[model samples]
Target chain A: MAKEKSSTKPESPAESSGHGGGGKSGGEVNVFDHLELLSAMGRDFASSLDIEASLKRAIEHITNYVNAEGGALFMLDDEGETLRCHASVGPVEIIGLTLEADQGIVGRCVQSNASEFIRDVSKDKAFHGGVDEETGFTTRSILCAPMSVKDERIGAIELINKRGGDGLFADSDLHLLEAMSASAAMAIINARMAEALVEQERLARELELAAEIQRSLLPEPGGEDYPVVGVNHPARTVSGDFYDFFPLDDGRICFNLGDVSGKGMNAALLMAKTASLYRCLGKTVRTPGRLMARVNTEICETATRGMFVTLAGGIYDPKTGIIRLANAGHEPPLFHRPDGEFQDFPAEAPPVGITPILADGDEFPEIELHLDGGTLYIFTDGVTEGYLEDGSELEVEGFKTLIRDNAAQDTATRLDAVISLIKRGDTALRDDLTLLAIDDAKGHAARQAGESPEPVSVDIEAAAVEEELLLSLTVPSRADRLKTIRNAVTEAAKLCGLGKDPAHDVVLAVDEACQNIIRHAYGGSPNGKIKLKICRTEGELIILLRDFAETIDVSKVKPRELDDVKPGGLGTHFIREVMDETYFLDPPVDGGNLLRMIKRL
Target chain B: MNHEIKEDGGAVIVALEGDVDLQSSPDARKVLLECVGRKMPVLVDLSGVGYIDSSGVASLVESLQSARKTGSNLILVAVSEGARRVLELARLDKVFTICDTVEDGIAQVRP
Candidate 1:
């Protein structure tokens, strides 16, 4: 290949028209014709957005200007392993011909990143006659040029059999073809970049839409005293984990946990449909087996691409501590009893969307469990497979240990601990972790009666949840500052619908409690801090006061007798007089004491 | 907490206002004890009090004890419903002399 030094631009087009027509063949056209052809190639390539059309016009102009009988333009496929002819002008139909990227005269042009000029194909060792043999077309001469844009090789263009005058190609032909291939290469690269940008935009919109759908599908948080708590953390844009629980008129709570087996839009849409199906059918279906069967049939009828959901649905009766549960290809739910024994209920049937019908009619196999004051945990594999703080997978054993360790916390608080355990760091979860816990409220009540540490498990578990703690304030244990607590308590009592007199009673009760914390818990040290939290759960209001002090033996702290009330000891008496229930709760954090008071609304 | 003290009809009238909690109860105790220590008839006006805790009740009880030792009549006047409830909870209602208004307390204490 010649060094590109000679100017293809003619001194004057009118003056050089004498040799303008390249039909003169191998005698070679004047610089005027080369100038016109080069400009025309640039124009044609730039004018059309359709890359194939531009390349076709470019190759035809190049072949005709060099006065060859046939020509073909080949492009490297996306993987760049093979060169396929995209446009061609020839005696034989060669538009779809394919060749290894490193074969024949054209392949050498691409590999060499330069032009090839062969006077006799049979004399050139790199020339391969496979095309001539297949098409019966004789090729005596060849001119090929590599097409490249900014160091990226597009492919090569090949011209065969010079048609005029000595029938041999010269250096001028190779130079002209090389200049025009650059324009063609530019067009192809630009088209690829534009296509990539469009695909990126399309995916971004789909992810955003899926996120909004997931947000709308999740239900309101379960109340504090309610036996259910759920937490969901997305791996990224959207995840397939979902759970929902709602109360029925008969005092039974219906709940379900599911992991849809896909990602992105498909997973998000299926989650919405399946969760709604369980919630809608769960209200009236009554039996867990029948509900799962109906939802399974519906999912199978509409779901595509072998997508499925591993689900466990149940109706919990708090009154009798009973749970009727059905598991469909989900991870086995762990039931942790108060005495520390765990029972696991694994999947009993195929996943929700895989089979349209059950072997035994339309009902799945169901198990009636007496939770008997134990807690039931249902979670997606994301939790067990998720990376923990130390970057190790939590797995099932680790998850069981986590539950046992935080077993004393309220259900919502324990679920939060599970979420943070797998959250790892500030980074989004590696996989979407969805966890739900069903703590038997009866168990909590029974444990509270026994003065056990069970009711002491504490958590503000606000894991992306609604603000359940209406008031949380930390103030110094100074006696004068108790007024602020009183005012806040009065407002909290009013917000929860306590009448004027009753509200004041609660206010004074909280005030007296703070005073006691200042006096007894802090040893009258004003430097100590007290954290007060007020929350309303179901039909009761709960006030929890936390103090960092020496732990007190709650059994020894007694309210003074009303008949024998003296000036200084009336604080505990006032707390017991107004609040329906009062207990010095066990603090989950070390060295701090927690006192809980409840007033039935 | 805010307070007003004056002599009215041969009685040391001590009126207290605002929520009398643990923080402000000392101030309340100061004003009440100063009046009861005079060994004169003391009429305690509590209508301005909105909320009172046990500490505030303790201050009042201490002042009442001082009044008894000094042989002075200590009468609680216009006790707010909330304060009355606290007093009743401590069974202090049976112990302190409570009247409907300052005039009633003054009439009862002077008669």
Candidate 2:
């Protein structure tokens, strides 16, 4: 592009059109005619809020009225730092283009907050030649005006190259352009604000839908004939914490509680996946350790970076008064024994989905407890981390004391008491709160009647005294010999007229107990001997397994935390789940331990 | 537990029987990993398997990871109800390439 110099100064229309000189070739229009056109343009600008279409019309009117070659309208971007070509009707298409806020004639008009009318192309220092160079559109004279609403400058409009008469813009053209820009600026601002509101409403509706889907995934509280109760309270509309329990076909309940890292939609989505996975895998896996490992593998494959799930879950056999639990990097559950003693089984492994915790070398410990007449309280960190009005936390000790205070209440009532204690005072929960309570209903009932707290003992003694010896066998404490022991136990169960389900359970229990003896009691030595005795009565089947190995430390033999999600340590869990009553008695004076397990028919 | 391995074209097919629990998963993993090590397509037919525990699932996961590393395809065929439920519970039903029968599984690998 070439720059040319022009030194003629623009005059006002009053100075140029004075004396009423008539043109010979064409009809002359007066100042009153321009006023009518400005009035009509103002009316048009006020009629519609479609900023793009209205601005296009306004630019068209300005260029046509002034008889210019073309015109373009620039608008301030969201950040208000640059000018963008929002609408243009010119020789070249520069729409969607951008320029610095203080770069050209248009920028000068915005900066000075005034209109510019030039008769020369190069003489004015404010004139920029970059647009002519880019679009190859030569310019001799131009009119530029700033567009603004209130005191805030929005952008500028520039009409290039006057087309008629002397081919130079006068002060009248700047006057008309300024009037049109004022209305256009207001229309653009109003339209943009409306669009933003619509977008916000759309997003709010979507979040509501997500919350509904999450609510449907939560299970109802309580189970029939089993004193199991659970509750979940989310800090936000959507929660990362979840708990679930459902009856399995074999007269047992499988339950789980998990807390996904983080909160809101991302955590909620993972919580749904983890909870459903537990429900599905918990049914067939039988062993909590194995079930958790399977879930960890799947979550590890799908979870995003820096995301994981801390979980505790188990299967409770109401008929056997036994519970097998597994923990994965979650807060240990509080186990309340009948003797008013409480124990916390802390995590045995890292949380799932963080790393490979279930591979060949990893270990997932399982805890097997005979509930006989006690309660197991499983919860998320939300409970222990709850804050009081003074900003002090109710740590694990405080939570344990809370449970101890409510120990005499039923399972549902105890859960409520704990929840109230955590939510007491003027403190708000910082995380999703979830709790699950499993109670031995028969034991609770016997305790309520002020009888001996050993409800399980009474039942076992009644059966043992009236029972008949079905079969008895002795075998070496070897992994290889477990199959023979299982076979013998199965035959004895069948002879007692037990159904396929119960018989299978009896065989599995005996096999697992024998395997534990071979591996744990005898340290995997094959030379040690084991004795098996089977008896059946009117309402129960009892089995006694004796091992001549060193006396087992009962406290040390407590089930390992299932959270480890490893490949082993599930034998004790299987034994407890399969049998109704299990007792690891102190070794006799002769140097042997007797494990007596009774399963009610 | 018992497993039978066969070959068809460039793919290896293995059919498993009995419960795939902690006690049996190691053996299943050995056989499955060997098939995957062939660096070709492998298909596991679990129609005869009655039960599968977490360890069994872990073995399958290992095979899957190995198959991805070797650029070989691993598919499950004729998954029994027990296995299918557990796989769905773990959400692996969506991750694994599963077919209703061995014939369909073979077609998937070949095609």
Candidate 3:
């Protein structure tokens, strides 16, 4: 574009000057003098869009054509707020200084929206002195005009030290500068617009990639028997908070919701990694508590030194009607009871991946709820710390009130109302918000209320016999070993003539037992020893695995969901699922941990 | 399982040509998902397959698990001695309908 204009400019100006006819200027007395000169000046000014080259050409053309000694062109900055020296030629020493609309002779032209002609710089109060000192020259005259665009004064173009042999800058010099200023202003505006378009294209491409990654990381809505809903709304193109849910075996639903500390692409990228790690490890490990533990370790290993994630994850047992949940310094979960009571469980701890040695006994938090018909609502700080109109943060008390006010609405409507309130009350949410709600009403329907069954004693002898036959004698505790144990036990139950259903039970049971040893006893160190003994007893095949390690406090432990995707402990639920009877014991006085598994044969 | 998928006409011939063990099961599952994703009938030939573990069998079972919904069929063909020994040892021979050759596996496809 610049090339076409530059080429056209020279031809038009020569034609107007009648230079192509090779006629010399006829002694200042022509039939059409000002008309020819004005046409030639317009051609010279309209030639190029390259601000640098056009400014250079304009200054030279003004000096030679109008017979001016020096000139300067100041173009407006992109914001239209400041004027900067863009180009200059001859003896105008001050080339790069900025001039505000009320600062100097040039500024006065922009402010008054008119041109100025000064015969002597010493007579003007606005003549900034630094230029004369550096150039070792005295400014004799100044011709200044506003580079106005659509009646808006963008900047001022000034010509100095005119040379018409003895007179100061006349009306013709000002007229010539005004014409050049108009075209130069147009060129500057066009160049800035083009630059903005290029930058926007680059940003659009980056956003596309981020959206693609975010979509791929989200879990599908339906797969297992239970129904689930997951939503993410980033304040920008991407969010630093994420939520994911997938199915697990034994009619369990695994899910996690997390938030990274910062915002933008960096926070979004970290959120993606955190979500992926939970999904991968959830599929590999069955329990939520263990999943979070491992996810914490992995994040600590790869994340920025101080980076951490506030996460909450658990598995919902659709059959058992229980939710095994764990938290990593995240918001306390809000519970809405079917009877209209609301409670927010505050079993919070430090955020995951923040510390290597979390308080061993006290820091490990496990909270279980017999979520008969209650709703578990989890969210990021963007929800709780949402800004109120007065700039104060919305605390948990306000959120509880919101839930209480909207308790009668359906689950979908309730969630929508909550989001609306947050948006209305807090126009400026300082962080990203993520919310997840799950209800186990159907699971509650499967059971009769108030049915009390006496707890039966576990037949240890029978479980030990079952474990002996099914389990691989003593294998190192790796995920691979878990696979080996799952397969071997499944096959043994089938061989024992327990049929397909019972075989699945035995497989799930043995997996839990082996995992307990692997997680709590061995700690995935691959150096610990675990023994398996499988046998048959009284219409059931019994299995017992023992590890000569620190005794596990069976009473202090809560049953965890086997398929909880994000990390935490899920050992006890796997036990409940696979075995008709589960028993935990410690050797009389020694440090040996025993887990017995039994399935009716 | 080391999956080597080759297209033959409209069908895909996925050659399981190595030991299908615990470590290789995930890769096998991914290949099966890809085949189903493309809506192709897959004849998984186990003739060159040397060994099969429970995890490998689980992958094949998962293929059967999701194939119907994905509108695809997965069949096993040409089980070698080593692989057959392992599958029979794990009692999965009764679970999967096996064929003696790749042609028979393709013939066993219902639709």
DockQ of each: 0.25, 0.10, 0.03
Better by DockQ, candidate 3 or 1: 1
How many Å off is the CA of A362 in candidate 1? 5.2
Residue range A408-476, candidate 3, lDDT tens digits = 765556667767765764355566667887866555665545332322223334334433444446777
The CA lDDT of each predicted structure is: 0.80, 0.75, 0.67
**TM-score against native, each model:** 0.50, 0.58, 0.53
Report the lDDT tens digits of candidate 1 across residue range B18-92: 888766776787888889888799998999998887878887888888888877878899999988999998899
Cα-based RMSD of the predictions, in order? 23.0, 11.1, 15.6
TM-score comparison, 1 vs 3, better candidate: 3
Model 3 TM-score (2 dp)? 0.53
Ranking by DockQ: 1, 2, 3
User: What is candidate 1's CAPRI-style docking category based on DockQ?
Assistant: acceptable
Q: Write one digit per residue (lDDT tens) for candidate 1, span A395-439.
A: 999888988888777787788888888775786677789998888
